[model samples]
Target: MRISTFLNVHLVSDSTGETLNAVLRAVAPLFEGVTPLEHSYYLVRSRRQLDRVLAEIESFPGVVLFTIAAHDLRDVLVDHCKRLGIPALPLLDQVLTMWEHHLKMRAGEKTGSKQALDENYFRRIDALNYTMAHDDGQMVHEFNQAEVVLVGVSRTSKTPTSIYLANRGIRTGNFPLVPKAPIPQALLELNKPLVVGLRVSPDRLIAIRRNRLLSLNADATSEYVDEDAVREEITDANRLFERQNWPVIDVTRRSIEETSAAILNLLADRNAK
Candidate 1:
């Protein structure tokens, strides 16, 4: 195995450092064996905050990525990095410049513009509230209000996927398929929402359940983690999906993001139809 090399990376943002972190994560893997040591500073809107951040950067001396909307603050950061002989980059400057050129206008000076309390932000909040309310088969009578409903056996990642979809302003809910329990009538009758079934391999399900049980300090010998029982559960879930004519996604090797993306595609196709 190749030895790992660590590189210090400084991320400064006037708002949440989500964009910087995401960009770093996307690019870091391309350089094999190089691990990033992240130093993230968020909400660097004031000069004082920027001063503290600069101190940290100077001490560590790393590649700097920032998304400061204030021009003066950005200038100070860039100049300081230049004097220190460290590389400083604005993450959104190129994209914003391209948009400005295309639209024949300069970008606004507003800080943390993406986090503004706009209609889309409110919509995402509403969707998140609805998702939390309807998670794990809760509020089944209101299932029709959801844009998408996920159905799956235990440990198939129903809850996390539902939340992820909700974050994208898609009202999502999920219901678990327990062994020997009859399917909820409300779920079966959800005509308005696109009901998607999540399926996982029996072996993967057992491993997940075993880890879950260990985390909870619960008995691992229960039928919940039994290989035969898990197999039967998955098979029954698959059959139910086929009987109901619902879309099914295998989550055995899929991340929550991947599963949610598939569900979004299914919802888009349904909407088109």
Candidate 2:
């Protein structure tokens, strides 16, 4: 049997703590048999807030990652961690220092710069709104307004992938490809948006559909979860995708992030052409 180890990880930030959480997620999977228990402290700007965070750090006594713009607060946090014999790391200092060196200028001492209410922030919000409005083949007539359109049968992760792309300010819309149903004419006539098809292995699709039915307490013995029927459904979807000449992504072994990245790369390639 494999052994498992649980580690306490403290993330302290003067902002929303998004960066620290992202970094922790990216690095935690690199180690086998180790699971990180996250202790997040956001908006740690004041000394009192730092004191509380430091107290928690002392209590847990684990790895600490911080992204504090103020030098004084950072110094206090680091010094406290040192006293407790805990490893402390500044997540953004190295990148900021490198940029400062390259530009021959000091980095600004501002907290939550990444979460600023800038044009890009508003654009992301707008994209999210658009994505929610156009989800599941809704607003088909406005497909022309989307940057990316995802088409896939049920349980292929079209909605989540569309939302993920929208979070990055790419206006995304997804439509479900129903078996024995005609493809929407609006989807076929789309000229602006880059339409991509998401597909999965027959076995994976069946498993997912089974779980979905179990969750809803619905009948699980229908054609939806039938092995042969699922295979035919996937085959039909693949044929439709091929006939439309749309790019297809096999999502059997791909995460939503990975699928979104592939879609973005496809969009980039299309723009380049």
Candidate 3:
């Protein structure tokens, strides 16, 4: 007597629920008009840990999608779902099984093998460190060494986009466009790196700066949050972008990925030409 338009899904993972969520993102769009209500359980490695999730699954029985690599724990989850008359699918099992057969080798004896401490992880760490060192134009001497430079006024999504680029192996540096501060000569002198400017709407910048000040428990009555001053700031930044002939991205409504994609496209075009 159970009928539903939406599917209840439990995403269980050993480490962060990133893997299972990513897989679901790829597959869920195929079934149109079907909404998935996801209950994500991360770091579920023990029976006691899974007991709460199992209780929830029994109440609204539906599909269980997981990326659990621990064999015994995986079996326990599958068996419990079976008893509830709920179907279970381990997203990584088929892919890993095929790799095991192809490579003529058994997989490692650990869950979350993809998150192993290795060379690629170290590279990411190094990139993170480099991003931190060069953030907010602190290390101007290293500006020439960057793969990409993000220049923008406050709350233009400069720092987050720079870090995102860094995580993708691009050594990114971001400098804030202060109202009257001098632009870095090193940035203008850089010959090989891509320089991208980020801009946001004055209203959006005002709202963002207001919230930021509130978060810091500081007064929000400064010129930083004034709409007119913010509008002038944006105008000046745009003028700088035009003066330098740097590609500009409007981050008012764009996600970090979208902004970065546009910057990446610019880099590709500049390199190609």
- lDDT at residue 146 of model 2 (Cα atoms): 99
Model 1 regions more than 4 Å off: none
Q: How many backbone clashes does candidate 1 have?
A: 0
Error of 1 at 15 (Å): 1.1
RMSD of each: 1.6, 1.6, 4.7
Clashes of 2: 0
**Candidate 3 error regions (>4 Å):** 1-9, 23-40, 43-56, 59-62, 70-72, 93-110, 206-229, 265-273
lDDT per residue (tens digit) for residues 1-273 in model 2:
998998999999999888898899899999999989999999888999999988888888789999998889888888888888999999988999899999999987867855667799899999999999999999989999999999999999988999999999999999998888888788898989999989899988899899999999999999999999889999999998899899999999999999999999999999999
Residue 97, candidate 2: alpha-carbon lDDT: 87
Better of 2 and 3 by lDDT: 2
The weakest ten consecutive residues by lDDT in model 1 span: 109-118
**Error at 235, model 3, angstroms:** 3.0
Score candidate 3 by TM-score against the native. 0.74
- Model 3 global lDDT (CA atoms, 0 to 1): 0.85
Q: How does candidate 2 fare on TM-score?
A: 0.94
